[model samples]
Target: MFRQSLPAGIGRMMASMLGDSPPSSRQGADAFPSSQSFHTTATLAAIPDPYKVLGVDRNASAGDIKKAYYGLAKKYHPDTNKDPNAKEKFAEAQSAYELLSDAKKRETYDRFGSAAFDQNGGFDPNAAAGGNPFAGAGGFHGFGGGFPGGFAADINFEDLFGAFTGGARRAGRGRRGPFQEVLVGEDIEVQTNISFMEAAKGTSKDVVITPLTECGTCKGDGLKAGAKRSQCRQCNGSGTRVHFMQGGFQVAATCDACGGAGMIVPRGSECGTCRGNGVVRDKKTITVDIPGGVEDGMRLRVAGEGDAPPTGTQAAPGTRTQRGDLYVSIRVAPDHRFSRSGSDILYTASIPLTTALLGGEVTIPTLDGEVKVKVATGTGTGDRITLSGMGMKKLGGRSRGYTPTGDLKVEFKVAMPKYLTANQRTILEVLADEMNDKTARRTMNIGKDSPPSEAGNAPTDSQKNEGFLKSAWHKLMNATKNGDGGNSASNPSKKESDDAKKSDKESK
Candidate 1:
């Protein structure tokens, strides 16, 4: 009954303002009869301090307050973060922002410490209509109840506070009011890989994305035709309802009736197109332009290319809508023959051993094409040859009329021949002898006398004598052990004796 009468009184008040006579004394008194059970008994002790909730100083500026709220919202918003307490912290930040962002609300809170907004304790709308509502509360002390002299009848609250809240009594065709919170849309990120050459030179790629877009059927309002919203009865349009707990503790939480929006739609009034969500999934193809000289693991940003914010949330009248950004992460594939360092390119070229010793022309592969380069005389292996302005083009060169390029460094590797013929060997040996190459002389077996002080090529006398004696002993033993007749044993022994005598004569 108490809930049913508040709107009736507002209607009557509006009627009186529109040239109708005011209600009679009996009618006015009956319209707002006191209801003890409907009055709130909760104190302000449990309410969190707005400044502390936002982690700001008592004297923070409005801009600073807004910045702090945005940072906290980004970290705690459910769309971006999945922490268990993110919703709670997000609610706390939003609640704090609501109080501190308003000049009148902040001033009142600073002076009265949240007690000024206490709706029930000793509050009587009928008595406060034309007189002081706090007269019995001892000069607004502790809100031990409500405000003293809430307001004079001459001052209409609806007109004065319309900008701060949804005015119930104001004449309007539809419900369009300031929302408590406005959240940005969700950001999107994607990754792609490009070849090494494509990274050196700019390229364009098409990326497919599925994102949330506003529903066209209902125009993002989430309402059927001719539908209207009403204030939630559970929370009295405060968006939060009080919860009583053990030990005299009181908690204010979001109203389940309206999903914390302070308003509820009539039964079966939701738009069928998006099922009251005001958004639908849509797949789109977007072209991304990659710049030249972009390094691996670089991210490119595209603005206003993400999901759109809900229609119900807006900063103010005539403010532009905000959309999130798109980020593209790039990965460059490695090349087979070429590697990069900053803006330079490195490559190795294999040249024949003869080409390194004598000046010659060798064809090398480069970014542009194969180019012939002259090898310097006596050029050795591991030598580097640099080709200026023949490497990767610098980033942003197309717009500058002339492209700036890096250098391509080519390293020379000498390739030696695996085999040589007799003619080649003889010529090389003659050449080594003319050049007095001691290493070649020691390594190769050319039938010639080696230089003195090097080891002798022949074995010593002891080596010859030991071989002759071993041969004679092995022959005699084998002839006897075989059990051959006297002729077979005597013939083998006779041959060994002759060979031993010949070896002794040569030594002498």
Candidate 2:
């Protein structure tokens, strides 16, 4: 098998293994007044150990597993390795160790755990083991072994160190600077809305918000009004105790008694109102700006408007609410006439048969206002009339037209009449005789709509052609029967308005 080298003890959170965890309290400790170099040197470095990598029970750790993983990863780590499978093997070892080392994670493994950690099944390492490609038919190797894990014996110290700790470079960031608080920004929430027109057209509006700010008094110092520092008796001015762990590597941390600053404050020094470190919690109002062209359910974020901190908190230190953010959720009410699609608006409009045929001006409702649009003489139903630049506001651009503007599609739904009058029917009969079934039948436009279940069945081609002819015949017969065929358009419709009124009354 191929082989490579890896440095030892890198990428692993060294403190997680041997050092005492931070105080049990959720709040962090007081800030340390000073910080020396926290960088680890050659003298301070520790050897690479699989136990360290997994963060496990040292007494329960094993060598076979580590050796197997180290071998595979060493081969493919790329830096010192050349085997293609080496990298995968290394990653496997890392994952296995991570789970086994964590107490909670290891407990799960002891149960019916699995390799599919993300699937919530369990964290398993051997679920899909590798094979030695060179092995024979039965996947048996000539080395007096089966290609079970197919891992070699060589270990890569260089790879181990680099992979475990991210090298000394990243480790530096984990070190202490001047001790500060567990500075957490304030969190806030707000409810807001935008109009459908504003959402489509894109507009900016102001929203008042409340947020947390810091107290000026203690200036974040948790001490009393006149409090001064007193030297710590235990551990002297050095605020912490240092001890060696994991062999010869030393660990140093804050003093438990004084909370790390190397000094204690007299009880009187505590602030009378805020108790010392000056930060206090208070709500302040602010104006947040919301931008336009936002969709329903979209959110507008205004940074910095939440609760403040209480000044003195963790070992690092705490500050009150400075500012959080405001998230405005846009909910545009549905307009009765228009529906929205992204930024476009849609609505249905109706026109009389005279206007559709002869042409005339019909009042069209635009978002800004209503305007009269000329229906050119002879305009058919389904004819589209576009009002350029009258769609929705562009997100970022202002100049451009035609394609940029929304198109208004006028789908003519030729409505005949709610009821017909005697005189109206007479004229309709004459018109039916003149045009026959040509335009009227074609404009019903039902066939292309949908299945019968959706819009009901369409008129048959023959049935449509007979509409005008039948109207004409009805008029002639009516005239001969002692009654005038003048109720075509203005009288009760063929739908039987009387029956409809009766049904409504009965339903009531």
Candidate 3:
């Protein structure tokens, strides 16, 4: 509990956190506590010491301290790492390293035994309390298992040699004292609701959030109303009570239950107004500015104005830092008729078969307004009519209009008549007859462009004669012969008649 090291600074440290106390110096190197029998604690018997944390010797040079600190820092600096507890370990290492790295303080710690700096032990150098911004009578020590002390190995070697350059040199003076107050707000989360139109179009609203606030009785300070905080008699001003086991052979460290702080606070009893808890409870109302076109489950962040900081002056629990961000989750309702497709919108439309065949104009729906769509005759069902720039907005971008929208993908479904009158049937019949007659005449009359061998083309006389002779030959060949096997009257013998004529002509 000595070092509840947090991510921020001292003002908000619960029981005293993230703070810096600078050192005030005396004239020359003579001011150093380097002499023996003064501030040094290394040779002391039996106690597990802080030197093991930074891993340097009792007489390690300033350069050595620098080298040790850098190496450990690389292994634990939370900023350069992903380990969950790296920040705390790094802070601990830093505190130890900072104290040892100072040549003057290191000398003072070396000369005067650690007990010499103790308030009740006679020679109070105010040494530990002096420029060590982190010191307050007593705080955290690694004995509690917070972080391993000697894990870093990347320290600048020059530091091990006690060089005066780099971060090894000693400072003459620095700032130190009780600091003023700066309370940060608490962290919180919230949820919001919106309509589909609002989600698509956009809107803003106010939300009220309730979280654990400060305690008002103590006026934000954890003291009995009108009471003051006092130092713990058990631990004295040093803040921690020392235990001597086996008659002081082995010494142990423990926190003072009375002080609650490692050292002293106000005095006698807590502030009556707050009853020791430094804060009070209250509700916060915030105006949330929602950007347009936010989809469902989208989040919005509202800064500050979250839960109030808890109150207490002791060093027990950690204090709050900056007010947590507010997250607004968006919920968009779904539309019944329209379906979104990225930058395109889809919908269905119906039309009469006659209208589809004859061509006509159809009215289509759009975001801006409705417009008549041109239906080219012979347009197939599902013929799409893209009304450009009419669609859903692109989620993340800078655009004045909706994200490349599209409109009216009207799919035409042909509608035919279910019932017909007598006159209608008659007209259909007549139309069918006329079409058939036209097709027959066209088939019979071949144009001049028709190929010569086509059957429908104009017929010549020789062709007609050949066709007739072929028909006659088929008819005669099928006739029955007379009983005498001479001739059938129906079938003519032209070759015989020709022979007789030739004989008469020869006789003449």
Q: Please name the candidate that would achieve the greatest TM-score relative to the true structure.
A: 1
Candidate 1 ranges with C-alpha deviation above 4 Å: 1-182, 232-236, 240-261, 264-267, 310-320, 394-403, 421-431, 441-508
Give candidate 2 regions above 4 Å deviation: 1-184, 200-208, 228-269, 275-278, 315-322, 376-383, 398-415, 438-508
Taking the tens digit of each residue's C-alpha lDDT, what string does model 3 give over 103-209?
65455556653433332212344434443211222222112321232211111122212212212111101111111112445557677887654555567888887
Sort every candidate by TM-score, greatest first: 1, 2, 3
Q: Provide the global lDDT of candidate 3 against the true structure.
A: 0.48
Candidate 3 TM-score to native: 0.40
lDDT of 1 by residue, 243-319 (tens): 55452223455466665456666567877776665567789988999988887998877766788755432212232
TM-score of 2: 0.44
> Model 3 — which ten-residue stretch has the worst lDDT?
171-180
TM-score of each: 0.50, 0.44, 0.40
Q: Which stretches of candidate 3 lie over 4 Å from their true place?
A: 1-187, 212-219, 229-281, 313-320, 342-344, 350-357, 378-383, 399-508
Q: Candidate 2 at residue 38, lDDT?
A: 19
After superposition on all C-alphas, the RMSD of every candidate to the true structure, in Å, is 20.2, 23.6, 22.5
| Candidate 2 lDDT, 1-508, residue by residue in tens | 2111211121022223324243334332222111111122221222234444434454565564456456655654534544555434454456565555466655644543332121122332332132221111111112221112232221122223432453222111111211111234556666666777776666666555544455566666666566665666764755554544553333444456555445555567776656654456555554545445566777655544555543343223321123344667767777777765654566566778777778788777887888777777776656766666666664545455422545444444445587754445545655764567454423222223323433666776555454544554555556656555456433548548877889999999
* Reference-based lDDT, residue 353, model 3: 71
